[model samples]
Target: MTLSLFSQFSSPSLLGIPLIIAALTLPWLLLSLPSGRWLNSRMTTLHEWFIARFTNQLFLPLSIKGHKWAPLFASLMLFLFSLNMLGLLPYTFTPTTQLSLNLAIAIPLWLATVLIGLRNQPTHTFGHFLPEGTPTLLIPVLIIIENISLIIRPIALGVRLTANLTAGHLLIHLVSSAVFTLLPSMTSIAVLTAILLFLLTLLEVAVAMIQAYVFVLLLSLYLQENC
Candidate 1:
């Protein structure tokens, strides 16, 4: 049998990408309203000291006039990371495995970085896109490369996430399916594959958190550089 790249997408609609994202997000949204008060209260705890310091540095542009966007951004990261982990489950769709979904997220992240940079230092924001210490003679060449790289970041981010999840899921599915098919009489083989898949699921959870952290970390660094 020929392997399909998107065989997972052909599954039942309830487990598809659109529903998966909604399923993961609805609870967070519903609970967040009530949780906001409690969260706000707890925000002053000692555990939040380092977080506040980091937030101050990253949101310096937004925090200039006693404004702070870290909570909203933090919420977004939590939602995305949870959604990503959901994809690692058996018979469940990972919305992030789809390029479109990842692109939707990555594009906004890139734009947010640019917007914050511009808000902080409009003149330098655009200038930073051009290499800092490059000679004027090579300014044109540097601009072309820098602009291309800047535009490519979101695309690359989307592809990196989607491809990893998609490939990993497909590999697991193939192995599980093969064991089921080839050793129909041997339950042990199928069981082994299932155990392996479970281990991979744990790994996927770690990867999801790491990917979310990486995205936000890079965004903060980008803001720092532009600022």
Candidate 2:
């Protein structure tokens, strides 16, 4: 009875107030806080282990200046990972599917990195616009190109996250609708389609995780450049 499939992305509300903050905070409820005891629960231990390993591997290639970004990046990875996984559940919404929210997260972080580079190492950052070469004629063109590309990073980051999640959700919904429509008339084909839907759902689960990782990974790379 829905008029538009895109309605699924609409934020839910209560008493005319949007539930955006609640949706964003839902992931934190799943995490267990560390205690003062000598032993921690399995999930807590695993969480800590993954955080340590992820932070270590991600920032290893960067300079010491970049090491300061580990806490921010690690927290972001976990937050994105949780929201993405939770969205796979029935009746749940993915905030990352909203381009506005994604852009809000991406632009400030990307701009901060660029600003840091300019503030801390202005000459080196300026060097990125043009490499050492004898092409005097192409300097303006190359500088313009590099500057545009630099400006596009945050937009790309937001769009990538939004597009990937939106596509996967749409595909899943389409296949599910097809399965329902075919069920009563053509049982055998519907069964096969249902199986395919199951596999696709599994694939989507992987996509959710990968997209989150890629989001955080690109941010780390940007931080690496600036730091």
| Winning model by TM-score | 2
Instruction: Give a tens-digit lDDT track for model 2, residues 27-81.
Output: 8898889999999999999999999999888888889998888888888888988
**Model 2: what TM-score?**
0.96
lDDT tens string, model 1, 1-227? 44465667543355444465465565365332324454554434532664566566557664343234577656656666767766665656677777887788878877877877778678887886675788998999888888898899889888887777776777777776766775677778778877887787677677777776666666655545554
lDDT of each: 0.67, 0.90
Q: For candidate 1, what is the TM-score?
A: 0.72
Query: Could you tell me which 10 consecutive residues in candidate 1 have the lowest summed lDDT?
Result: 30-39
Q: How close is each model in CA RMSD to the real structure?
A: 5.0, 1.4
What local lDDT score does residue 180 receive in model 1, on the 0 to 100 scale?
A: 76
- Candidate 2 local accuracy as lDDT? 0.90
> Each model's TM-score, in the order given?
0.72, 0.96
- Return the lDDT, model 2, position 90: 90
